[model samples]
Target: MEYGEAQQEDESTTKAAYNPTEEDIIEYARFLGILEEEDAKLLFIAREGIAAPLPPEWKPCQDEDGEIFYFNFSTGESSWDHPSDSYFRTRLVR
Candidate 1:
């Protein structure tokens, strides 16, 4: 069987199964305008069986333009520039 077909079959045999294609995830991320293309791609890769977990000090944050980035508190760095002096923030904030 093709790799995708096998994956779908395996997923179907499990409860609460919902396997999303890479393209689908990327498109959805783009639609939400929450993640920059590269960030979205990295996220997709991370979700797809990357051996290591994302850095513990890294958090998902968004810019004023609604583009998502990874903010590393330990390093005081981000995947993209954010407003100075502002805490790393996400849309989930109330």
Candidate 2:
């Protein structure tokens, strides 16, 4: 998959760091499917931005067509365009 460009701006909203232990791996494997060695879960979790493995299931991305596609969240890569900082404003009320 192709990745978009990264933009920078003032930000404070942070994503909490999470570490996955052995049990976490097992749970994640249960969701992503177990590998021959059951070691690929780490890769999958990392690919999914693995902010603490929680059941290995989450709302990974909201697509361009307004579809909620579920998958592993990759903190490394963003699947869509999101304001990386507070410079941009989000309008809630119409």
Candidate 3:
């Protein structure tokens, strides 16, 4: 099988026998090397069920392609990536 197909099969098998926790997901993301450790944790907080809030001025938007982006009301600035992602990461770590 191709690498992507093999990975999908392995992940399915792992999920079939196990209920993964937030930390487990984080660790698995780290193992995949898709994101740095800190980034993975922040991603969980941002997209999973975490209750953290972004700064009031920043709003999240999605393009037609369904990718998320951020816009700052105060500065009228926009970015494809979250502008305060680093700040959120620090807050989550503390």
Candidate 4:
């Protein structure tokens, strides 16, 4: 398996699936009262896999979105950045 990809047991659908639809993304942002576009963009990228794991120094969150604790991918010079179940729920599935 490719690094960062998941195995059968990692399926989020079968698991606690946190796949956020476009609507969900918007709602989540509002729910958290995060109005900054950059933060929203980061969250959006995160929803689409442009996001990455929080830095080693960062602590893991108990939620699936993990946006609450998500560290910025880049401050001024960085760029770039899983789960699922039945019917090929990729990203989370493997």
Q: Quote each prediction's TM-score.
A: 0.35, 0.25, 0.41, 0.25
Q: Pick the candidate with the highest TM-score.
A: 3
Clash total of candidate 3: 0
Instruction: For candidate 4, write residues 1-94 as lDDT tens digits.
Output: 1112211122233224554567765554444444546454444433433223334332222234322222222332211112111111232211
TM-score of 3: 0.41
- 1-94 per-residue lDDT for model 1 (tens digits): 1121111112223313446666655554444343654464345432332222245665545455555455665776655432321222232122
Tell how far residue 4 is off in model 3, in angstroms: 36
Better of 1 and 4 by TM-score: 1
The lDDT per prediction is 0.40, 0.35, 0.48, 0.33
lDDT of 3 by residue, 46-71 (tens): 44322334467766555555555566
Best by lDDT: 3
Please tell me which model should have the higher lDDT, number 1 or number 2: 1
C-alpha RMSD for every candidate: 16.9, 16.0, 13.0, 14.0
Off by over 4 Å in 2: 1-15, 35-94
Q: Model 4: clashing residue pairs?
A: 12-84, 13-84, 83-91, 83-92, 83-93, 84-92
Q: After superposition, how far is residue 18 of candidate 3 from its true place, in Å?
A: 21
Task: Give model 2's TM-score versus the native structure.
Answer: 0.25
Which regions of candidate 1 deviate over 4 angstroms? 1-20, 24-53, 80-94
Q: Compare candidates 3 and 4 on TM-score and give the better one.
A: 3
Query: For candidate 2, lDDT tens digit of each residue in 4-67?
Result: 2222211222233345666765554444444525445244542343343222322234445544
